[model samples]
Target chain A: MKKILIITFACLISIGSFAQGNVITKHFADYQQDQSFTKVNVSSKMFSLFTEIDGEDETEKAVLDAMSKLKGVKAVVSDSGTDGAKFYREALSRVQKDGSYEELMSIQDKEEEIMFMVRNDGDIIAELFMIIRGADDFVLMTLYGEIDLNQIAKISRILKISGLEEFGKLGGN
Target chain B: MSSRFLIYLFLISSFSGFAQTKLIKTLKEEDKIESSYHLYPSTLRMINLQNDPAFDELIRPVKKLSFSILKPDVYTSKDMHTAYQELLNEGYEEYIEVVNDSASMFVVGNESKSRTCILVNNDEEYYIADLEGMINVLKLGEVYESIANQDTSKIGLGTVFNYVMGENNEKRERAKRRKEREKNGEKEAKKESFQVTIGEEDNEKKDTTSEQVDSLNAIEEKKENE
Candidate 1:
């Protein structure tokens, strides 16, 4: 009985350690508990609806395909009461320590730091993370999918998603 | 003989000061042209409630709506100025005129119960909302606060007034929801669905309806995702 209890406890400790080290999961939990942020989680089915958009150009189609494969999307937008810069710095350091995400590009434009990070295996990008920190706005978006940086840029232009134009430029860099 | 005089006096009082209701007459005349568009009462009631609920109470008593936004190259500032003079001559009282850096909005209406709202722009665009009830012009203005981009403005207002009049993804989604609710024996959902016909033909009068719905969907989807 003592030996069995020891083995089960060891397994539980390893699992707990694994979950805590993931910055994305940790931030999602932290944001949900904090009232200052508006959080949204969209399922894969909802993401697939982007594919149904008619009259899309070739680039739009490619982006839609990548979007459709997304497992899920999560975002948190902080309100005025919270200090965005502090939270952004904290989150960035945690993600850096997590080590799976590698910084793809970073832009420091007047009173804001926008960064894009990705987790990839060879040419296939497994996940994409975007952290935007501004004077009044702080947004962290996590898209779990096989997304390419070049495709994200094309999607941004067609959909007119502001600040995402930088992703297209990152490919050339 | 006194009663006869009273009847004669009533007829004269009713007929004397009225300016012959020229606004509705002008709208009917303009509607006959190929370019102008009007939304009749039957169409106004069909806007999908899930899209914008503001139209529900606001457009209830609207008898008809006619609007036209001419291409910049086709109509000039001089023509719009001439039309403004014609509206005043026809007894349409000018209410509010808004001039911003982007564009200008002119609003004119009669003080009577049979209100005729004529909104003209310096860009040679036009908007006419012929209502059956007494509507506060200021309240009606609130409904159109989201409108921008001259060409889309007409379709956006039209979509608000008549969403089902357009080809929209919301129409299908609403229908599916209605069906699910019906299967589940939801009374309110059934009532709403029955009020507005499902699978109706898309109004071909304006090809811009779908484009307007697309713009609205794009904006709303972004908000929803964020």
Candidate 2:
């Protein structure tokens, strides 16, 4: 009993939670497996975007574009590509017009998965996950890197194709 | 305005109108075609794949969650070299192998990009990727593609690919046998290593069990000598 207790203690001391990449791997797999990964994450932001609480559209669009550019990313809408576009529009609106800057930075870090916005030291990055299946399957979409959401959204909007009503739904992850 | 200029403008406008009429005619004819013949191959494929077991398996979570991390099991350099050749053959001549274990990506169209996405990771349980949904067939067994397009059936490409992986009876049997052989080999290797370690430890402690009896016998002999 004493040997086991010591061994267990030693193991706990040696391994940190994040250090164990296997756990993270499992989480990614599990979240993706159930199709719930994208659903939960996308809906989490849908409320904020729908209400236009703040710079939601602007932030949303940037995240969408960044995800589209990412490798392993396919389509970026479930409701429709238009909904994804609308979400991007909301996301882009949130870009720093004028704020404490520091306050925005703080709120961003607390933001959970499916959406994140960060600006610091003149550098900026925004990423968000979208429900990317065709109104059925849900897959996570990650959009991030050093670029403004507004710019990406503008470019994306210009490229929008026709025949997508669900795509126009603004509520996006 | 000169009559010559007017005539030129009229001619150009008339030609444009004529061309527009022809485009409309073509579109109308396309619309007139029956709905059954109008379905895109990719769209049909998407419908067929909805009921496939393999597709469901891909979307489901693994119980133990093992993904074969795309690393070089044989030769590291050779694996990279093969990826490069494959990219080049695929018509994306650009290649890069920057960091170890990270296969560089390559883009064949639209942009000049090099990416390493076609990796077979065996251990990383979860693989979430967005792929163009059109490709539907995979062929294996024969070294070459079928010169004889014998069958009248128009099967989705994914079906043929799945078949090659385990569709045919012969292929399925061969795969099963191969897996069994590999499992047995691994078991034997483990047992051999375990035996060697245990044998060494046992040898070191061989005389300790009977040491007390031997010591007593030595004492008896000493008493006799006295």
Candidate 3:
């Protein structure tokens, strides 16, 4: 009976780890089908293809190198309607409750609120999550798999991905 | 019977390669959407007509291009969403989606070799482009910037469509110039008409010009006397 209890606890721990990796998908699954929300899911295969491109300059090369390490990117954006702030708050509360991600930076003003968080695996960052809420826009984006804080800014600048600019605050790690 | 079934399956699999093309064709035919198709050569020619080598380089990897415009009355935002879902079901992965108050766009691609479609729906109309080939998706923003920032005078609707589809004004102009040159049997004048005379050559040419003017005056004086 003790052995059986130990095995069940081990299985639960493993499942929890798996769920931690997919926190964004688990939390925002409803937005995937909602017509009002714009959903984006870029597979690892696309990032791998970026590695095959020969960068034309040093900055491009650095960006490509950083992108190559990324496993995938998922974003759920709601720019229409007035529920942006509501969605942002919901996502924030859920992420906080999950306790897998640590908040890195947050900014709140009269017009907008932006938050940046990351899930770390040892010394390397495994995931970077961002939630931005403006007057009528909300964006929740997560980039997972082998992230480098030092190169995140460069990647965001070159890619010009929406809501990624918030992660640029990480500077260099 | 088994061989026949296998042959039918093979035909079905082969048609999947042109899924985006087939979709555009069907949309145009069924909904009567205004659409235009340009093959590789015509697309290249259109890019070349821009006279910007950079634009040509930007579109180098595109094998074919097609554009369709659907009026908002005919294709509502709900209809656009349904079409987007249909595209996702067709094995294309959504790379990015941007939605703003005025417009929304979805960029999706199947594989590196397959077509990348950009569907932009706004309050006014729905614009779709079927681009077949391995276009670097990363550079799409750059392409949009270049095209958007282009001088409006240079990119009239007629120039992009009528010019590529039927008329070739540039070619006609070239032929007309050639015929004029052949009729006169004179080579086209060099771009720079003024000759450069350095140092001593400059002084000598000035002196010769004055001497020729004096001689012409002398000849006129002699003719007047006669």
Candidate 4:
């Protein structure tokens, strides 16, 4: 009876932890298991490389400065082959129930919608989660560690990376 | 007057009048278009944005906000880039420009004063915003980010215009009130009332400066370690 009770308690603890897993880890695992999703993981060390990317513009230097503070970034994109709508809905619900995040903004057009959420420690944003659900595409991106949208926007501008400038509207002092 | 001078004046006046008439006609047509929207400070303040903290500072200092959502394919990528180049040629200083796979954002501002203009175009639609007053160029990203977060269909461009105007009005009113109180010889009263507020602002500025310093130090340390 005692052995059974201990095992049951351990199981409950594990389940609870799983339910409250790190936002990126929970979704990233799903991306890995599903062949339909494209997962892109850029570790902290790799983020530093953004600083060295050649660009004559001053914004390039700003991007390097911003990338230096970044810890990690993970993105999961669903193509036409995947049930993107289903993944979008599930991810949205999961983030909604997750206590660690605060919904910052949401925009929708026709059948497409995008949501921005963040986990901040005081003024410092630790994580930024973006969910984009379109008619044919769905994307989930989570950026970790002192994430500053201004710097990210500058980086995007310098690198000619489309759609990243939208993150700059995330709000800062 | 000489016959030649009379003839020149007649031709110049006629052409000027013709050009003015054409300009007036174009302005009237634009005003009649239902697709366009205009918002003032009073109308903007009335919009309830659910008091979202993200917009707390983003909307301030905006004297006006106006945008028109154009249909897809109306302006090709080449056309957009050409227009940006024209603005540059016209001596509009480039503030910040971002060209990505999906869309592009271009900003231009005056050398002196706070007047700014932003143009964002994608495959589907294009938008233009004219903002007055002091606006931090860096914070424009946050403004765009906030816009990206909203339900464009539900909120429409009107909401953003109104919100910005409303915040601008609020700032104006506060400044007006302060000016009036000062004129009434209530300097001591004003000092007492704004003591805490001024202290808080000072502290906030100090905190921001310190954080930037620390971040710079961290970057230097990382470079050394590398």
The CA lDDT of each predicted structure is 0.52, 0.30, 0.65, 0.54
| DockQ (CA atoms), all models | 0.01, 0.02, 0.12, 0.01
Q: Who is ahead in TM-score, 1 or 4?
A: 1
Per-residue C-alpha lDDT of model 1 across residues A108-146, encoded as one tens digit per residue = 878888888887756777778888888877878766766
Supply candidate 3's per-residue lDDT for B218. 100
lDDT of 2 by residue, B138-195 (tens): 1110101111131212324334323332333454467679989999999999999999
- For model 4, the stretches where C-alpha displacement exceeds 4 angstroms are A1-22, A50-59, A160-173, B1-226
Q: In candidate 4, how many Å is residue A15 off? A: 18
CAPRI tier of model 4: incorrect
TM-score of each predicted structure versus truth: 0.40, 0.25, 0.59, 0.36
lDDT ranking of the models: 3, 4, 1, 2
Clashing pairs in 1: none
RMSD of each: 33.4, 25.6, 22.1, 32.1
Candidate 3, fnat value?
Answer: 0.20
Q: After superposition, how far is residue B110 of candidate 3 from its true place, in Å?
A: 3.4
Candidate order by decreasing DockQ? 3, 2, 4, 1
Docking class of 3: incorrect
Positional deviation of residue B213's Cα in model 2 after best superposition, in angstroms: 54
What TM-score does candidate 2 get on C-alpha atoms? 0.25
What docking grade does candidate 2 earn? incorrect
